[model samples]
Target: MVILLNCAHHVTQRLQKTFVNYGEAMMYSLESCPSPWLRTHSMWGRYTVSFMLIVTQLGFCSVYFMFMADNLQQIVEEARTTSNTCQPRQILVLGPILDIRFYMLSILPFLVLMVLIQNLRVLSIFSTLASVTTLGSMALIFEYIIQGIPHPGNLPLVANWKTFLLFFGAAIFAFEGVGMVLPLKNQMKNPQKFSFVLYLGMSLVISLYICLGTLGYMKFGSDTRASITLNLPNCWLYQSVKLMYSVGIFFTYVLQFHVPAEIIIPFALSHVSESWALFVDLTVRTALVCLTCVLAVLIPRLDLVISLVGSVSSSALALIIPPLLEITTFYSEDISFVTIAKDVLISILGLLGCIFGTYQALYELTQHNFYSRVNFTGGIHV
Candidate 1:
């Protein structure tokens, strides 16, 4: 994060200093860099970055869809089995026992409609509500976690190498907000203080992640589900937590969907006449939303899907690209050898993580043992 922020500081400073005519996005910075070595492949890198961003954002949307479905399914199942008065079964008459995919499909139309609102101002309202609900849910989850934490000796502080790859992938996903760093800095009235903002924000995020991860693991041990909310007691208050978090994730889906739609819809409509542009835009939006829902249904397991997406795309965007971009952008300048070496090392680590993490995630996705543990019988394959 320090290195990415430093690179972003450099990139944005260059944008303000020399590349004032260009855009402030990562792609623009790559395309307009002064280095001759970088210029040759800048176009390719630019397009690749766009593709990766699209994949990362859509991957997030898919994860959000699955997250909402999973939480809602757990809540509804508990309600149907436990509560005689609260009958969600009668409303969702698909079957006495609905699979996870049914829950994904049930919420498809609402998701599609939610993504149709293009105005960020309107979406910001939902985003604020999402934030509030998410914070509330996290508080409840933390309350649950601290209650039954077992001895540290009983837990594996360091997991084995094979399972570590999954952890690495998920960690990358959690820390994969580098794309927003530049945007936030650029929009700030006092851009010089952006570094402080970055430091404080990351500190809080990392601290919270560590607290929740360790305590939740200690509490649940082997029975921990993909989401900690799913492992909560099947009661009214905890079920409300599931519902609140689901609502938060549902609203967040559109925020994630916005970036890819902005990139894809404009490029797609460039080929068509102005008369049919609106129709094409709406069709593409609906199609993109439905596509994420399909992907979520195909891989209903939240943890595995999150790891797969993070390894495949988040590693590139968050870990690999920024350092390489820094090296490429500053290659023509009087950059120190140690700085260059450090950048190369970071990029190499990111590359290796991406390769191994992706392989491990894919292997788990294809294996029967993992599915057997989850009792996954969605028929797409284990």
Candidate 2:
């Protein structure tokens, strides 16, 4: 916790200095630095970031795809008879599409739509709806969680130690919004208060995570879905919640997806003729989205991808990169033992997380074990 917070502050300061000292023009991303390696410039290091960014963004897209598909699948399955109190079976609106087929087919419309939008940032106008609908769905989930507190069925005080790394990775994935920090800070009306804003914002976010994680696990116990939203009852109101949440995520997808897509474009465009550039670029973007969807289908397990990406990328971005950047930017020579030890320790933790968490997630994926622990029914491999 100490290292994480310190890294956040240091990274913020580092970013501010980067904007001022390195000139704002050079700093294209939170991940960018003149010295990609330790006190030395290396194209290899830069490409490493690019590679991680590519994988990270693709993972995010897969998550969004899985999320939408899962919710729709839940709605369809539950429409038959998933609720208590003996309510009438609800109608399945989308007809008799196989769950996996729907997952793959549904992505096509978005893929085509994404290609049509020349200006990706234009989706920023929808950020308001994203925020509102996300919070609204969260509110509904929290209400369910709170109500479940009185009768939490066989809640465990201590989960298995092996699962700790998985949860650690997942938590990092969940907390990731640091990429937007620089932009949000830059756009603030009074940029001076950005630190306070960051701290306060992070505090609220952490509190919310604690509440959700605690209440959710307490309520659902071992039956907790990858997303708390999926645990909601199969009814008109809850189904509406899932739909609204999915829509919000749908719009937000293009927003996050645009960055890596933009980063890849310049390199891709350089190879094509001026007249064919637009067509080729669109082709590349479409292919990337398709690849992401394919990955989602293969590893339909939401837990695996979220944990793997978080363990693989989030750990490096949040814990490893910032510390190294700090060392490079601040101390050219004669760094202290304390500083060296801190970074090395944090980096090791990050590495252990990435290695183990990724292994666990991948192993689970190979076993086709997306099913909840208590309800494992030998899931079909993709």
Candidate 3:
């Protein structure tokens, strides 16, 4: 009887243990089961939201680029046709100071774009190169025009090949954003290997600039317009090139416009709905782009604008800002006096260029009406 009781007790204990283990297993199974329908629906909803967001952003970029195509073409066409003597009335009216303002204005979009975009390196490289190409072409054209001037005040300044070289060098100084490669240097996948790549890229750009400037100068002499596009031989080849250039310019500017709006939208969203913020941001950006395009189209003279931008806007940003930032930030480091001196010299050159170039443009503007004036003799004057 006692043995039976012991067996029964043992069985009871075993049953209790089994019951506890089963309960724990059941709980674990319940916890580990696939999510409920509501949970799955919520997760899918989030993914859908994310996908839609990405699609919307991409769609916006596409539409924006499409809208800018015509304007880009026009800019290219203008660049191709722009004479060495071309000057914009706005530059004349605004003066060098205004050039600085406009330069700042142009930069605003770039900065905004950088902040908004994911792949900034590509965008930056493209925009910088485009600007450089445009400006370089303008410089070549300007050189041609300056050479053509019968009694240019600074005739001796550009008379000899040596002086011409110096002038070209100065123009290149205005083309200074090549320093952008510096900031991007460390970002490369293999930074050490990139030195060769960077050097090669820069060499190619320098070579291209020299070739274009030399050819342009040879073709147009002193009468070369501000844009090399104008200097292009009016052959099928040239026309095709011009069309391509125009397309590039259009895309560059469109990207420029899109960048600012996209960046500002996020900031604006603090006070407004995402959609409304985007709308307002884009509206403002579009207005600015339209205004710039109108001015560029109406002004038509590439040289004057180029000179204005070169001397004032590009100079300040390219020459002034980087050195200043570098000095201020890296002052404690082993910076050389030579570097400081160089920065000062660059800044001075930029300032002088801005003043002199604007003066030239304004002097020209004052001498002639952009629109044809009718003479009393019933003849139209251009």
Index of the highest-lDDT prediction: 1
Q: Tell me the TM-score of model 3.
A: 0.50
RMSD per candidate (Å) reads: 5.2, 5.7, 22.7
Higher lDDT: candidate 1 or 2?
1
Q: Per-residue alpha-carbon lDDT of model 2 for 1-382, expressed as tens digits?
A: 3333343445556556533211121222234433455224344445665666667777787888887887777666567654545232233233334655465567657655754564634555666678789889888777766772646555556667557767767866864554445544444567678677778877987888778877776665665667666666666777778888887887777766765676688789998889999888878888888887888766677766788888888777666665664454434446697997787787888778888888877776677644322112111100
- Which residue pairs in model 2 clash with each other? none
Distance from true position, residue 225, model 2, in Å?
Answer: 1.5
Candidate 3 residue-wise lDDT at 310: 44
Ranking of models by TM-score:
1, 2, 3
TM-score, per-candidate, Cα-based: 0.86, 0.80, 0.50
| Winner by TM-score between candidate 3 and candidate 2 | 2
Q: Show how many residue pairs clash in every candidate, following the order shown.
A: 0, 0, 15
For candidate 1, lDDT tens digit of each residue in 1-382?
5665665566767666522111234454566567666566666676787788789888998988888887777777668555423211221223425777788899999988898898766777897899899889989888877874678687656667877788778888885465545544555568789789789878988888888877777776655667777667766877898899899988888877877887799999999999999999999999999899888877777788778888888998877887776675666577789988887887889899999999998998888443222422111110
Over 67-113, each residue of candidate 3 has an lDDT whose tens digit, in order, gives 23322333443454445443421111111222212332443354344
Lowest summed lDDT across 10 adjacent residues in model 2 is found at: 373-382
Instruction: Mark the regions of model 3 whose C-alpha exceeds 4 Å error after superposition.
Output: 1-198, 255-271, 372-382
Question: What's the C-alpha lDDT at position 56 in model 2?
Answer: 75
